[model samples]
Target: MIKAILFDYDDTLVQTRKTRYQTIYKLSEELFGTKITEKEIDAAWGLPAEEFLLNLFGRFSSDIHYLWSIYIEFSKKDLNIPHLNAFDFIDKYKNFVKFGIVTSSSEKVVLRELNELRVDTNLFLQIQTSDHTAVHKPNPNVFEPIFALLKKENMNKEEIIYIGDSPADYESASKFGFHFLGIAHDDRHTSYFQTGEIPFVRNFLELEEYLIDQYSFI
Candidate 1:
């Protein structure tokens, strides 16, 4: 039986494409006076947000630190990120399966938005942020800790489904031997979804139904 459900944040559990794009565009304009196109910004969606900004603002990681800090301050103001309502489904099955989050977003940024939305971070069994590991997703190393944690719970990768909205998440699940459920509304990973090799849900509500019907065997 399935024993755990791990999720990707940002565009997966919460709607963040617009906010992420706007903040990056704003920061790009402020730092280099160049307005980055949506296509340019979308190209960097699944990677580490800081590293993405670093490349855009120039290779100087040192400069990215300061610029990203300023950008964080700007992000917290009026960020209208909507909770995707998938949490209720998670909570419904809370007693039977472990629910957790693993995301490329930094702890500060994720926690800030979670708090601002009054969402409880403690709902998950474990929340792994970008700061938790040096290697990012699509790298099997990033999921080693999660695998170990689930092992402690006596669950195998086959009994866990990883839900996300990015190619990185897709590859991570494939590499790590977990079932992957792609969410498509973000459209950030649309090209990756074009293959239809993996199962996908267009929105959280559909995902909830999928989990309820498909994994009810748990």
Candidate 2:
């Protein structure tokens, strides 16, 4: 039986993609003097923020660092993006199973967002962010801390589920032997997971149903 669910922070736990794209695009023009298109940003979605910056800007310079600082400052403001049904989801099943977060995001931003959204971070058994690992998703090392923690608790790989909104999440979980579940909030994710024959859900309600029906998560 699945005993835990590790979540991705950005598009999976919260709806930050569109707003994030807008922020980056606007800042790219202002800071880099390059008017990057939303399409370009979309193409590089799911990468770690610094890697995304390097991928677009072709280097990680002082200006790139400055841009990241500005982005973090911007994130401190209300982007008006509502978190997903994670609060209710965790509250419902938290007693039955452990919860964790594994993301290619920074700990500072993730914690800040969770606080701003009024989520009880204590409900999580562990949180492995980019800061917690030297390498990141699609590389499998990003899951090292969480995976080790689970093993120490006698939880097998099959007993954990990794839920996220991107292919990188699926790839890393697969490589590391955890079950994968996709959050397909848009056509791109839906089509990608469907093409890969991966199981996915449209929202937390459907996710609840999927867990209950498929994993006996009741």
Q: Global lDDT of each model?
A: 0.79, 0.81
On TM-score, the leading prediction is 2
- Model 2, C-alpha of 94: deviation from truth (Å): 1.4
Over 156-179, each residue of candidate 2 has an lDDT whose tens digit, in order, gives: 999999999888889989999999
The best candidate in terms of lDDT = 2
Error of 2 at 196 (Å): 2.1
Off by over 4 Å in 2: 30-34, 57-65, 78-80
The count of residue-pair clashes in candidate 2 stands at 0
For candidate 1, report its TM-score.
0.89
Q: Worst lDDT window (10 residues) for model 1?
A: 53-62
Q: On residues 1-218, what C-alpha lDDT tens digit does candidate 1 reach at each position? A: 67888999977878787677777777767765778888877677677867766656654346777867777876776484765666677677687789888998888888888788777777788888888888998896788877788899888888999998888889888787888889888565677678757788888788877887887745
Query: Per-candidate RMSD vs. true structure?
Result: 2.2, 2.1
